[model samples]
Target: MLRRIDEALINRANQSLLNELEADYAALGDKLARQNIDIEAITRSAADFQIAVPSWGTGTGGTRFARFPGTGEPRNIFEKLEDCAVINELSGCTDSVSPHFPWDKVDDFSELKQTADEYGIKWVSVNSNTFQDQPGQEHSYKYGSLSNTSKEARELAIQHNLDCIGYGQQLGAKSLTVWVGDGSNHPGQQHFQRAFERYLASMEQIYKGLPDDWEMHIEHKMFEPAFYSTIIQDWGSNILAAMQLGPKCKSLVDLGHHAPNTNIEMIVSRLIQFKKLGGFHFNDSKYGDDDLDSGSLHPYQQFLIFNELVDAEYRKEQDFNPAYMLDQSHNVTDPAESLINSAIEVQRSFVKALLVNREALYGYQEDNDALMASLELKNAFNLDVSPILAMARYRKGAAINPLAVYRSSGYRSKMAELRPRDPNATGSGIV
Candidate 1:
């Protein structure tokens, strides 16, 4: 039997680090006091921060070239939940999961929900799959799904979204995310206005089907499979579609989905100002949509994005709550380890954002002190809040050093022994 990482193991691990943690935490706390910042409040906020894990993220992800499958790749949604449970148990902040449709679709949603409940997980945004065709589908999404010129294809895509809503209702999810690769490859191949019109028509049906409390998130990518143009190619189109759909719809931001060096934080700010920001699919990239782990290459970018988020919170922006979830594609390293690390990095960013003196930042903005304003942000970002993060985990009964303890658990080796690998498994890689 595969033994899960239990309290005994965590206690043993924490023993060696407790004293060091206390010393570091106290020193940081005293330093924060000098600046009139309450470290305890930040620790509480850190302990309270939550990000939903993508169920498919538990398995090995790939690049456009190839996928080097890991030793214990999850064979199905059941196994994926097991891995997700382990991640949440150790990481402390990721207690919910964002599941993709068709890939995670099971015969019995009741059993699936029960299984997730047993694992202490709630469902978040339910992701729909019209981007790719499933086995024995009536209409092919080869050219497009929502914006397909074929009425049959558009109806099929719309029905699938309604089914996704049904599935989410059963699992208690409050949101649905839709991202379609519906565009052309050659110049003048598609009627831009006509394609968008068709997409809006399809999305209108799905939006009408939403539960009163549910929000429909439309995610946009600069370019992909369709290089010339995509239907909802940027935030402008995304928000336009959302507005046309209704108040239940909004635009979702994926960090890696923009052009290189795009000012994503400004986009986030705009969405927030209009109450059209649905949520986020958190991931980092060096180029475009590399799907690198969060904070891997651009920690400051993540921090800046969070700076906007924290500012919204400080100002009590109405209807400003946004869902946070990690959407990385881990091509290398253990998926679970990468998730824990990313969760910590995200948590670290939020905590550091909290350290930013909002009042001072506001004053700097008002006075046009660009240098001091940049310095204020840099000062907060430069602070190492590791102690606060560790203390939060320790207080919440999570591992002080989650990745270290996860390594000690050997969970992957045990899983590899229990489940045989599938040689023909494929993934949603960039190709």
Candidate 2:
């Protein structure tokens, strides 16, 4: 194993903040007591929360046109896991990684598993990259992949996904996430029903290939690379495909993949009701799939999503387990620092959502008291839960102020020397 952030450095950094942290935590506890909330309970929930980091996100991301590479971006999957380990060390909430294949593919799957084991990291969903084609490719995905008009292209896509499942099994992943950029660019360019039919047929084969213990997650995107329409365009189509495939197949929601002003929480509720909600690709977006940091643009929206999630937990809803992973594309900031901040922001949402008085909210809803119902949600969203989040990290042997400790450790600067940048950024390059 490589040298991690020094324990002494973290201890020193945390010691400076411990006094203030305790004071704030006590004040918050006192405030919550009147509302019948337990600060310790909220802190424990936060400490127990674990969001997986996307391996691709460990590198600097760019817009559709340009990429501004950072000094020490991970050159391969192993290097990416190294950076992911550092993020978990500081944040303490990201114990697993969601890896994308063809991008993260290697000859030795056993070595990858051993490397992750040494770092105490687990694998979440293994993502398939049918959106872009790889080198020496026999088939081009320019028109489409799984839903391509040509049978050969569709078969190639299906095989790639099956191959991803094979790779994931060795890495200890229980799920496969499929997001295809297959759609029509022009209105008359393609027939909608026929295209969807083709997609379902291709997916059926991939579904059949899944191990009995594994699941297949279908991710939908509104638009990008193809503007007119996408096969799995929204939740409606996502669930439809899931239903057609079988029980183990379900929809994976990406926060940035929806149309503007769409009521995502309602969609999440709908998915939960029918027992088809699979997982999430957590990120914030101002426009379309901007891949901004989590909870950056709209913390309230993030909290609202969590509110529904916590409600499901409160109700003891069966089959409610949804894997959470950060899916931002960091362009300017250090990827590790951005990941640390994103994890805390997400944890902040979860912590605050737990503060909601479920009984009060339910009563207000039952009575149809609009104002009180609104206030019930607003009240929980408005509170600052920083102390609880910090306390959780402190108790987990993580940094009290994760970002501060990360900067103090100088991990990035050191990595710049160890993993020098490639002249040509190969994987997911400039697109």
Candidate 3:
């Protein structure tokens, strides 16, 4: 059994860290010299980036076809917190956890809050699980939950979301996320208008249940359980639903929930423009909802999205802050290591976005110099900002090389011993 990794590997990664920081700082100084921008101010701004980890993601994640469970995977919420603590301790970027209802449901809400606090983990957003039916569920969401034609089924779905909101309030969570797996596989299986009307009607009740300070996030997936079509299928539908639900409702962008080659960052820009961007479920996807690690497949795309986000922040756009959370499953790697690496990857994107020569880009845009504007973004993306990231982690008492530290510590093997592997296991029902 592997014990946790030692401190040497964690400390050794600093050589590259120092080198990267030096090069980045020099480059940033040059860019600032050209435009009179403040490099120090940008570095300070980079220190403020944070994203929440999903509790469900702490466990071993598998595809619909197959799942290979990890040895020390967390079996419950408490164990999940332990994994999250490791992630935060090593990465210094993930300070919160987004919990899924029923999957993370427990009796002692107060105790859960205290436990999380002890681990320096805050509950960011409470996700409602209406995609599948739970034990003793009176209504079946077989066809759909909110969009189901059956009045009883729709009513049950509405109640479940409301209940989730109530749980969020108890847990000191400020937002509720709703992702329903409701759509049709075969043609003529459901009516479009009536189904959407039912969904809207059900959502209205859930909206009313939200506390004054709470925001409701509607997550839309193009297709999944229903291969043909899905309600809340695109950003347009998501925004329309949010508009109907009023100011408190906003659309959440899950990176894996889109068609291949979709301009997701453009969609993000549009949502920010409308002031209806609630949050994001960050991940990478090759085919459809691959739920792979963030910045693994399309790092440039991630950087581009952050480019738009940093643009909004620079302008001080109203209601510009968007919640961010990891929504990837660990199928092959240690769940803890994957999460820490993913969080750091996300931070890398944010850091790269911060490096974008905003003034130059703005000037190019004003002069209508499309090539220069494109060049400006590419310049920032091309620069490696690893040192700045390492410095931030160092300042926060995290490891310079999080994955190396985790591996040297041998945390996973220790966990395997503590929590014996399950011979016959059940799936997490994510795909």
Model 2 vs truth, CA RMSD: 1.4
TM-score of each: 0.98, 0.98, 0.93
lDDT of 1 by residue, 1-431 (tens): 12257778998899899999999999999999999988899999999999999998997788777778889789899889898888887888999999999899999999999988888889999999887778899889998999999999999999999999999999999999999988999999999999999999999999999999999999999898899989988999999888888888999999999999999999999999999999998889888988889999989999999999999999999999899999988877899999999988999899999999989988999999999999999999999999999999998878999988998988899899988887666644556
* Model 3, residue pairs in steric clash: 3-409, 3-410, 4-408, 4-409, 4-410, 4-411, 5-408, 5-409, 5-410, 6-408
Residue-level lDDT tens digits of model 2 in 1-431: 44388878888989999999999999999999999898888888999999999999998998766778898789999999999999998998999999999999999999999999998899989999988879999989999998899999999999999999999999999999999998988989999999999999999999999999999999999988789988988999999999999999989999999988999999999999999999998999998898899999999999999999999999999998998999999988999999999998998899888988999999999999999998998999999988999899999888998888888888889989999887765545456
Clashing pairs in 1: none
Regions of candidate 3 where Cα sits further than 4 Å from its true position: 1-39, 427-431
Model 1, global lDDT: 0.91
Model 3 local distance difference test score: 0.85
Candidate 1's error at 248, in angstroms?
A: 0.9
Tell me how far the alpha carbon of residue 373 in candidate 1 is from the true structure, in angstroms, after superposition. 0.8
Among all candidates shown, the one with the greatest lDDT: 2
